[model samples]
Target chain A: MAEEKKRIQAYLEQLKNKVETQENYGGEITNEEARMDIRDCPECGAGRAYHKGLTACAYCGFVFMDTKLTDGVNIRKENNS
Target chain B: MSGNPLLEPIHGITLEDYGAACARLGSGLSEDDVAKALGVELPVWQEANLLWPERMKQDATFHIVTLFGQYFGQADQHPKFSGLKASASPEGAGNIEKIKQDKDFYQELEVARQVAYDYGLDGAQWIVDNYGIPIGDFQIAASLWNDQIHRDIQADYAGYNQRQAAYQAKYQQLFAEKQGGNVADDIEF
Candidate 1:
């Protein structure tokens, strides 16, 4: 019985020492690639501006930019008019 | 070695199971024949089953009401008649004469009424066979139709917005350079 108790005590001490000596490693933080996402309207801050080249907000009617939404793969063109 | 052919009991064989087995054995059988063999009730297919009779009724009623409303409005505009009545007075007499002359108008109304009734009764059999009901209610069907339309429009709008976003991102740099200066300040309204 004494030998069995001594064996258990030694195992427990080893486990405690191992746990105390263990170090926690964390993941590194990296910068995300910037992309155009929906942003709040600059004027009213209530409505969202989905695209960067929007002339005005759809909800608040706040003008965001002068660029006109033209046809083609390029959404906006210089509004010469 | 073949003396007597072994006979299996056919007591528990259902018609559907037999038909399936026959089909697997490459038996060329029509669907109706298969259904008949299985003792399954085949639904009566009809064109009327696809239409909503209530919708037709509503459409007819609306058209008739609008037509009458327009006629009354026109009659009201005349200075002679104060209200709708057939009398010896010039205004009333003239209105009655006009109505009597308009045989085409009365014929149109009769046609409309008949068409409405025919349309309402047309697909009744089909509805019974398909939906297990004689007629479907207009409001519920209309609500469902509108909901579907709304969802379709929303999905289309979402797709359009996604394409727009992709286009904007693709030419963001070019647009910024083209504007010469801050594009935000150049916007008037």
Candidate 2:
């Protein structure tokens, strides 16, 4: 278990360095973090995460890209199984 | 297969629009890749959609629904979709329609419906068969008639192989007739 922890730590460090050095940088610090942010709309507090590139909105019938992620407060712990 | 425009109405989108929609759906693919797969210039595709919207609409919708159902079943399961009417096929009755009434079916069919509209009969069937829908379900059968149509298309391939064998035998007979008394050492094509 200790050896596994050390290996994971080393791997994360490598990922950080790669992200910093890459010229055409994309994605945020971590997918997990970005996913948390995109789970709900940035403007209104709506919970629609997946966008279909359509004009009409399903909830509140809002017709804009203002939808935000909705479940950050209740984020379940990641089971590393 | 169902050429009834009234039953399977066009979405007022041209070939160009259809291509653009397909590109939008295939956001991860490169532009060149899209061109090779769709076989059309971006502008021409747009114009074709504007002109002959009916030509491919039924096929595209069918496909989009299939994709949506697949995506829904495996990845995302939307709870709100349960409220909407689930009947998308003519023969959908009792438990068949009940099965479709679930949110997964709605999501799946939405993806497949677009496919049917864009790729027409073949595309529609491709989505249905790839999704591996069970046979004898009416709503599944109705929304996915292209599956049957596709099987019909494959029948020609099976028929052709059988005919080719018969032709080969006939050719051998003709060769024997031409060289009835020829020695085993003499033969030509």
Candidate 3:
């Protein structure tokens, strides 16, 4: 029983030492600046739309695109079809 | 001014009665000026009448006449504006029917356009074809679609920030337990 307690104590001390030195293991993680695209309504000439492919103007009820804005991340491919 | 009906104290005066009283007074005002003067007094009388529960229904009748006259005047000045104004009148029952039919078509178009804007051209086309919505309506629909994606993305980002904060708190608690001092309190200069 005495040897078992000492073994557990030693393991705890090793974990404490590991935790203390763990700070140097990884570099600081920082948030990146977000990018945004803003555009104006063509019909009303007053309202602004943010995002690359917007469908309509909130003001004056103007529709900007016949197509829907892409869902999820938009990607372009080269060559093929 | 002694026998003037305009100045006479009456129990229940209406816009028409007031107009007649103004005419009897011989105020020498133009018809437009007389109407403009009565327009100012109409609301006051209506409001006072509204205070009496017995006259509430009469007040509603007065509102109907007032609104009709207001729109009629506008219709006389601008015939094109008369379409919307006429639809409000009982005489425009046919126009109301047409508007109802158009309203449904326009509503569907609006939804399809919104879907297209949210999903992209191919997505919008697929919806239009599958739904059998008129292609002509798509143009009108596109005009009404507003971008809500940025707002959704912003909301998602906020949630992410909240989750990040929770993770940070958990890390700090774990670090504090392992170390002698609270990890959050440890200042690095």
Tens-digit lDDT track of model 3 for A1-81: 675566557656755665454332112457889776444676778544344224456667665433221111121111001
lDDT of 1 at B174: 37
Could you report the DockQ of all the candidates, in the order they appear?
Answer: 0.01, 0.01, 0.01
Query: Could you give the DockQ of candidate 3?
Result: 0.01
TM-score of candidate 2 against the unseen true structure: 0.18
Q: What is the lDDT of candidate 1?
A: 0.34
- Chain B TM-scores per candidate, in order, are 0.17, 0.20, 0.18
- Which pairs of residues have clashing backbones in candidate 1? B48-B123
lDDT of 2 at A1: 64
Poorest 10 consecutive residues by lDDT, candidate 2 chain B: B74-83
Q: Give the Å shift of residue B178 in candidate 2.
A: 69
lDDT values for all models: 0.34, 0.36, 0.37
Once fitted onto the true fold, the runs of candidate 2 whose alpha carbons sit more than 4 angstroms away are A1-5, A17-81, B2-11, B14-17, B24-189
Which scores greater on lDDT, model 1 or model 2? 2
lDDT, candidate 1, residue B97? 39
Against the true structure, whose TM-score is highest? 2
